[model samples]
Target: MRVFAPLLALGLMASAAHAQCGGPFPAFVKGLKSEAVAAGHKQATVDAFFSGVQQDPKVLKADRAQGVFQKPFIEFSRRLISKQRLDKGRAMAKKYDATFKRIERDYGVSRGVLLAFWAFETDFGGFQGDFNTLNALTTLAHDCRRPELFRPQIFAALTLYEHGDFDPARTTGAWAGEIGMVQMLPRDILINGVDGDGDGHVRLKTSAPDALMSGAKMLSHLGWRAGEPWLQEVTVPADLDWSLTGPGQNLTVADWAKRGVRPREGKLAQGGLPASIILPQGRKGPAFIAYPNFNVYFEWNQSFTYVLTAAYFANRLEGSAIYDAGTPEPGLDGPQMKRLQQKLAARGYDVGKIDGILGAGTRAAVQAEQKRLGLPADAWPTMALLNRL
Candidate 1:
C-alpha cells in the first residue's frame, strides 16, 4: 500500500481547484445559497458553509475511477474477514455487547451486524479520515461524474453546519465526506443521525455511542428484522437451477426448502421469511439466500462483498455458530482478468473494456458464456472458467 498523502495538502489543493475552475461554480454556489435561503437557512448560514469551497481534481479522479461500480464479491470479502479483522471484530462485540444490545432493543438491528459495520467502516473508529468535512463534501460536489449524489451531500453538510450539528471548520472526514465510525454521509447525518449516547447532541465525530447508534439506526430504517439472521448459506438439492440467485425474487425459507434448498447448516425450521439468493462469483463460488435485513447492507454500499462482509462480520462479532463457509475460488488478478475480459469481448461477450475487474457486466457476460457452453449459469468467473477462455 502506498503511504497516505498529507491531509492538509489535500485540503488546500481541493479548495484552489474549484475556485479557479470557473465552470459556473459561482452559479452553483448562488443556486445553493438560494436553496438554503428558501429552506430557512439564514444568509450567514449559507455564507459560513460555502465560504472556503473549491473544486478538487483528486476527488474528480476518485469519482472517475469508480466507473462501472462493481467488484468480485469474494475478492472484496477476503480482506474484510481476515484473521486480524475477525479478531478485532470479536473484541469489539464482546467489549461493547451492552451497546450493541441497546441498539438491538431499540432498532431491531442485532449487535453483531452493527458492530460489524463499525469495524469495517473505520476500523472500529481507529481512524476516521482527516479532510475538512465541508471541503471534502464541496470537492466531491464539484466532481462532475456523480454530482447529483454529491451535491446533496454538499447541501446536507451545509445544513448540518447551519444547525450546529457539526462545526464545518473542525470536522474532518473521508475525501468522499463520510464521517464517524460508520462513515456516514452528510445526508445520512441529517436523516439517520441519532443520539445514542444521549449527550443532547448527536455528535458522530467524537462520540462512539452516537456513531454506532446512528449506524444501527440507518440499518433499522432500511428494514432490519429483529431476531432474524440476514440469511444463511444453503444446500440446494442437486439439479436445482443455481442461476436464480440475485435480488429479484423473494422465496420463503420453507418455499426454498421445498424446492430443494436447505440451509447448509443442517435443517432450518419452516419459517416462511422472505429471502433472495445471491450467487457471487457464479455457481462455482458460495451462494446465500438473503433476507430483508441483507438489503439494508446493500443500502449502505451496493456491492455483494460489502453486504455479506457486514453480515459475516456481524456473525463473527455475535459469536454466531457459523461465519463464512465459502471456499476461496481462484480468480484471475488484474492483468489476467483484463486478458479474460478481452477474450470474452472478442468472442461477442460485449464486456465494456479489457479492465481486469470482473464487475457485474463482466460477470453477466461470463454467465452468458457459461449458459452457451451448457455450464452452470451462475456466472461465477473463476480460473476454472478462465481455462476455457
Candidate 2:
C-alpha cells in the first residue's frame, strides 16, 4: 500500500504565460489528456494524474534561465563538489556499505560513482525540489521549446502513476520533472527502476537503496564500465599539438605519454585503453585524460562541465588527490562569451549560437581565431581573447 503525503489544498496560480509566451496552457493540457487516452492510458488515470495541475511559471522560468552551463569548469566543479559535500558523501558511503556492495555486485557500477551522482543530484537526498511533477512536465510539454523531450516524459510519469510507483497526489520533484534522490527523469525510472531493498517495489523518494540501485542500473545500461578509470588528471607539455586535446581526439595512455602527457601527481598506468586529453579550461587550466567510462558521464548529463564535475567528485570519493595541473586563468563570463561567439561567427568560424556557452563549436572557433592571431591555439576562451574580439 502506498503512503501518500498529506494533501495540500489545490489553488490556481495565475498563469504567467500571458506575460511571456501567451500560451493556452489549459487547452494544451486538455489536448494532452486526449492524447494520453489515445495512447492507451485509461481516461480515469489521465484525469487523476493531471488533477490540480497548473502552469508553473517558475518551472518555465527556470527552464528558460539555465545559465549555469556557461560557467567555467573550475568554478562549476568547485561549487558542486565542496568539502562538506565530499565529507558527507564519504559518510554516506560508509553508512550504506552493504547496500552499495550489493548494488556493485548486481549492477557492476562503482560505489563511489553512485554516491557522487547521488550527492550531486540532490545533496544526499537533503532536498528534492517541491514543484509538482505533473504540473512541471505539463508546462514544459506545452512550452514550444522542447515539447518533443518533455511530452514523452509526461506519458512515462502517467504510466508510473497508473502502476502505483508513487502517489500522484504527492509526485513532487525538480522543475524539470526529475524525481527522487538521484533526480532520474520519469522515462529513466520507467526503464531502469529497481527494487534494491527487495521490497518488491521501487520507491525512490524514501528508499536510498532503491534510488542508488536504480541509478546504478541506469548507469550500467548507459554503458558504465566497472573498474575503469573515468578520468585522470595529467600535465600536458606546452609545445604539444593543441589539436590533440578535447573529446574527439582518442589515443592510448602510451600514445599520450609519447606526446609528453604525464600524470599530474603520479605515474601513468601501463595500458592500451584509448583515452582523450581534455583541457577543460584550455591549456591554462587542468588537463585530464578521459577513459571510455567518461563517455557514460556524457550519457548521464550532456553538459561537459557537469560530467567532469561528477567524474572528478567520484574520484575524490576514492581518495584520489586533487588535480595538480594548471589553474584556471581569468576568463570570459557568459555575456563576454556571447560577445566572443558573435565575433567568431562574424569571422565565419561558425560558433553555433551566441548562447554564451563555450561548447565544442565555440571552443573550436576560439582555437581557429587563436591560430589566425598567431597565438597558441589551445581552444580555451580567455578574457584576453574576448577583449581582442
Candidate 3:
C-alpha cells in the first residue's frame, strides 16, 4: 500500500443536490451518491454511506506528494527491511503456520510473500492507519487527478456496508482507501476476500487468517506461480551484454548460464524458467534474475523499487543471503531527472509525466536511449547517460 503522512486535517462541507466530480466538494459527493444509487444501491444506504463523509484535504495532499518512491533500491530496501521486522515476520509465520500451509496449498502463494506484505503494510497489524476509509475514498473520488481509480472503490465499500462487513464511520485504513492488515482496496476485497478463520466473516483488520488467506487468493488470481522462484541474486560476467537485460528480454536460465550468469547461491532454476537480469542500480550494483513469478509482484505494487525490495525481502525470508551492495554510481536528482524525462519525451518516449520520478515508463525509455547510444542498457539512468542525451 502507498504510505502517506498521517491525517493532518478533517474538513467537512455541506452537501449539494447536483452531481459532479470536481468543483464544490458537496456536488462531487452528491454525484457519487447518485452514481451509487444508479448502480442499484438503495437511496437510504447511499445516504448513510455518504453521511459524515467529507472531503479530506490531507488525503488529496498526500496523494499528490508521494515522493517516497523516489529513493533508490538500496536505500529504500535497507530502510524498510530491519532485523525487528524480520524477527516479527518469522514469528508471525510460525504463529500462523497452519493457515499459511493451507493458503499455499490452495492458492500457490508462499508464506514469506504474504508475511512480507503483512509486515510492510501495517507492521503485522500494529497500526493500520487512522484515516476514515469512506471519507478517504470519497475525497479521492472527488479529486480529478485519479477519480476513475478511486471512484469505483467507493461503491465497493458500499457493498461491504450492505453486507454488514463495513462501518462507514468506524472503518479506518490507509489514505488511499485500502483497508485492513494487508491494506487491500474495497474492490479487491469484494472479488477475492476469504473467510479464512471460519468465523463467517472476512475480518481482515482483526483476523490474521482472514487477511493472509485473502491476500494469498488475490495474489494467486494475479498469476502467482504455485512453486516457482520469483527472484534470485546472480553474478553477471563483467563483459556481459547489458543491452539484453531488463524485463522484456527474458532468456532461459541455461542460456543465461551459457553467458556466464551464475546464481550467487544455490543452483539455477532447472535451466528452463524464463528469466531476465535486472540491474536496479545499473551493472555496478546488485543484480537479480527475475523469473515469471516476479511479474506477479507488479500486480501488487507498481513502484519498481518497492516491488524489488518486497520480492527480495521475501527471498530473504526464505533463507536467501543478503544481496551484495556493490559500489554503484549515484542516480540523478529531481531536476536532472525531470530534464532527462523531458528529453526522452521529446524523442517520442512516453515517459508518462515529467515528474522527476524514475518510474517504469521512464526507466524503459532510458534503456531504449542507452541502447541507441551504444551504452550499457541496464535501464538505470545515470549522469553520463543523461549528458550523452
Candidate 4:
C-alpha cells in the first residue's frame, strides 16, 4: 500500500471529487468538509480549516501564467543564478554547516543540492510567499483543471492544523499552496518533513535548518541517490552524431566519452553510470551529461528548463566552472511553438497540452519527427524543424 493510503483513497473518490470540484464555491466547500469529516478528520477541525476560506482567482492566474519558463535555458539560468545568490548560498552553507552536515550524513543529500533549492524557491527564505495557505489550497482544489492533485493537500494541511503547526488565516505561502522556504506541498511536508532544530515541530517558514533538512529529506524520497553526481557540463565532438543527443537517449559515460564527449571542467562520473547528453538549445549550444540522480529532479518540478537550471546551479554552488554557450540556432516563439505542437499532435504524437512549452512529451515528438525528416534529432525545436514538419 502507498503511504497515506486511507487519505489517498478519499482523495481519489470520484463521486466526492466530482461534486466538490464541479459545483459552485459554497457547495464545493460543503462537500469538501463532509468528505473530510468522513475521511476521519474531526468535525471541529474541518470546520475551522474551512472557515472564511475562499477561492483565490490570483492563484488560478498564477497557475496559468507560467510563460516565464518559455525562456531559453541560458536566459533562464542566468536570470535565476546571480552573483548575489551564489555568494548568499555560500554564506548560508557556512551558517548552517552543522545542520547540513547532519542532513548529508543521514539523508545523503549534499548541501549544494539543498542550497540551490533554498536559493531558488524563496530566495533563501527572504520571501516564502504571501498567499493565504488554506485559501490557495481550497481555490486549487475547487478548480476543475487539477483537483485530484490538490485535494489530498487539503487534508494534509488539516493534519498539520490539528498538530497546531498550520494556521488557516495566518499561514501564507506560494500561490500553489506550497509552504515554507523550499516551497513544498502540504502532502510532502506531512510525509517528509524533518525537525532539524529539534524544537518538536517541523517549522519550515521561520527556521532555516528546518527548511533545509526538510527539503533534503523530501528530495531523498524523490529518489535522489546519496553522494551521486547529477549534472556536469561537457563538450561534444564535431563528428558526433547529433541524432544521439537529448534527454531521451541514455548511454554509459564510457560510451559518451568514446563518442568524444568530454567534461568541461571536473572529471566525469563513474564509467558505468548511465548518462544522457542533453543539448538545451541545439547542436551548437551548451551541453551537459545528466546522470541517473538527475532524473529525480523531475519529481520536484516538471519543467525541464527549471530542473536543468537548478542542477547547474547546484554545480555552480560547488565551484563548477561556467559553461560555454555556443551560438545556437534561433528557436520558435510562443505562437510558432504552439503551431509546432499542434502539428506534432495532429501527426498522432502525444505532445501533451499544446501549451507552447517545450515539455518532455513535445521534445520527444520533435526528436522523432526530426529523425523521420532526416534532420539532426537534438530535440531542440528549431524554425527549420518546424518548417519541415
Top TM-score hit: 4
User: lDDT values of the candidates?
Assistant: 0.68, 0.79, 0.86, 0.86
Candidate 1 ranges with C-alpha deviation above 4 Å: 1-27, 65-75, 266-270, 321-329, 335-356, 382-389
- Which lDDT tens digits does candidate 3 get at residues 95-143? 9999999998998888889988998889999999999999899888788
**What is candidate 2's CA lDDT for residue 364?**
79
Worst 10 residues of 2 by lDDT: 1-10
Tell me the tens digit of each residue's lDDT in model 2 across 304-335.
Answer: 78888888888899888887546667778778
Candidate 1 lDDT, 183-208, residue by residue in tens: 88877777778987777888887888
Query: Whose lDDT is higher: candidate 2's or candidate 4's?
Result: 4
- For residues 1-389, what per-residue lDDT tens digits would candidate 4 score against the true structure? 01111222433244643444757999888888888888788898888889889888999898888887888899999999999999999999999999999998998988888899898889999998999999988898888877777777888888899888899989999988889999888888887888889999999999888888888888887788999999999999877887787785889999999999999997999999999999999888999999988988887887899999999999999999888999999998999999999999999999989788998899888988988998887888999988887
Q: Candidate order by lDDT, highest to lowest?
A: 4, 3, 2, 1
Task: Work out candidate 4's RMSD over C-alphas.
Answer: 3.1
Q: Per-prediction RMSD in angstroms?
A: 6.6, 6.8, 5.1, 3.1
Worst 10 contiguous positions by lDDT, candidate 3: 5-14
Candidate 4 lDDT? 0.86
Model 3 ranges off by over 4 Å: 1-20
